[model samples]
Target: MRNMRLAAALALVFILVTTVFLGGCGQKLAVAPQQGGLQGLKKLKVGLVFDVGGRGDKSFNDAAYEGLEKAEKEFGDKIEIKYLEPSAGGENRERLLRLMAQDKYDLIFGVGFIFTDSIAKVAKEFPQIKFGLIDGFVPGLKAENNISCLLFREHEGSFLVGAAAAMQSKTGKIGFVGGMQSPLIEKFETGYIAGAKYINPNIGILSDYIGTASDAFKDPVKGKELTLKQIKDGADVIYHASGASGIGVLEAAASQQKFVIGVDSDQSLPAKEDQRSFVLTSMLKRVDVAVYETIRSLVTQKFQGGYQEFGVQENGVGYAENQYNKELIAANKAKLDELKEKIIMGEIKVPTSKEDLK
Candidate 1:
């Protein structure tokens, strides 16, 4: 009977050991999934709203998207990105921004100045969210702490490209096609005219706007019509800062066998063979670089809110020189380089408005 009791006691001890070991194994399995779940929760959410031309315009909007894409590739699963293109009227812009903010997105960006008012309204309501405005500033917006304005010295870059146009023009007359007549676009117009005059005092400049509204940026029909008008008026080389509308300018230039300068991205890179032949160069606005850097700052917890101005001195803007425009730029390399240095050194002041140009 004592031997039997000893065996039973030994069996009881074995059961207890097995239970403890099995419990530990279960806990280990559960802990791994929980740890992984916690890691997955750490992703940062980002939202972007494109301007009128949207992402495929291969112009300003595409540049912004490129920045987002770059950040996504580098961070991988660490970040979640979403972008929206508002209706042509942009009546949905405010709603889109609010939805993103309500969903607790970490950072949101508005791609054009047209969004300034909408962003300001939503940003005020959601003080916890971070907002970025490109080529746009909401003057006197109360949410200064949560908003950052990214602006560029477009005039400085325009000046460089305009000089190239002047030098490349077969005819003494050139043209400037603008998206709108606002102070913002006026900067581009004045700079182009100033740079042309800097090269040749008597150069004729034919300037026209696609329209008087924000939609002008995407109006290729108007872009083509205006460009044709300029070409008819003896303008052989054209410089356009009209976003997607500039594509039409390129088309017109090619059709007419004239030269053209593009804006924002390296327009020459995406041009068709016919268009490529006429694309002299593009004003590199560095919008993608700016957007990427801003998002990086946010991810690293180093983001600062306020006005951030990028200029030629900051490498924020310049002219693109690629295979399509290499020979053209090479011919004017010395003059263009000299003008760039002068602008950076403050020896040359590129006007930012029609009034300023006067």
Candidate 2:
């Protein structure tokens, strides 16, 4: 009887263990059911492909991430948000985008102008998938129905900061550091110089381009090198249109006891303790607003495609005047507002190219 009882106890333990093990395996294999919204519509899935300087750049890429986060907050479980940062250049972007499409993402966004060609190609291949391309519009592409291009009046905002730099400079010299010498970056240079000259007819403006390649946007060491050169050349104030590379410019300013203007987003918020004090102001490019609006449109089924340009008149670009730099910009507020009015009123033509400035 004792042997029989012991045998029964061992059999029960074995049965319990097998049951628990199979239950665990079952849970692991289970998939969450597809969720729906008010009208039983499926949840929205969004995929974002960030350029080289992804979320932590504290500049352009961060702004885009903010927009995505905003959308996720608003929709909650009704949406799925995913972002991809390419390990390499062009081909990687193409692969990431293609994979997102293959996964049937309801919407996708490419964060920079660098993705223009890759997005154009992938977007055309996936005609049914909605795509948003920031900072660039592919020319001669007929995928307008499915792709939306978001562009900015970077020059207009650059002009405002340029005026501020001219007014605030103690050395009668200011400088511009651009990521590349492309036409897009040239717009920033032209407008900056023009606005500076408009403020002080005799102001000396020094300009430098980081490089001719896309990688220039990510090269801060080179940015620091160029900024030091400009400072040595007597520039007490500088503005940079370079992306992540601009961080170096700000660092150099703090080290050299000069002033630096930020680009894209309000950069003062991300600057280190010492660097924040030297950031005179920033050219506020409303990339975050554009990105959020695009996602909102997709959510509401009101998505529009084709080339869309956001400008000063649309409040798409302007100067940053937060607590970090409000006191610094106060002295130039009246004149800056007047210049802003002229640009919006069509009285002042903000040059978008070097030739236009001439």
Worst 10 residues of 1 by lDDT: 137-146
Could you tell me every candidate's TM-score relative to the true structure? 0.89, 0.87
Instruction: Give, for candidate 2, the lowest lDDT window spanning 10 residues.
Output: 31-40
lDDT of 1 at 311: 92
Candidate with top lDDT is 1
Which portions of model 2 miss their true places by more than 4 Å? 1-41, 88-91, 140-144
lDDT of 1 at 151: 94
Q: Model 1: per-residue lDDT, tens digit, 1-358?
A: 9999999999999999999999999999788787766665688999999988898887899999999999999876678899999898667888999999999998999998888888888988998899999988867544247888899999999999888888888789999999977888888888999999899889999999988888899999999999999999999999998999998999998999988898899998889976797888889888898889888988888877788889999999999988777887797989999999999999999998887888
Candidate 2 positional error at 15, Å? 48
**Which stretches of model 1 miss by more than 4 angstroms?**
1-40, 140-144
Give the root-mean-square deviation of each candidate in angstroms: 3.7, 9.4
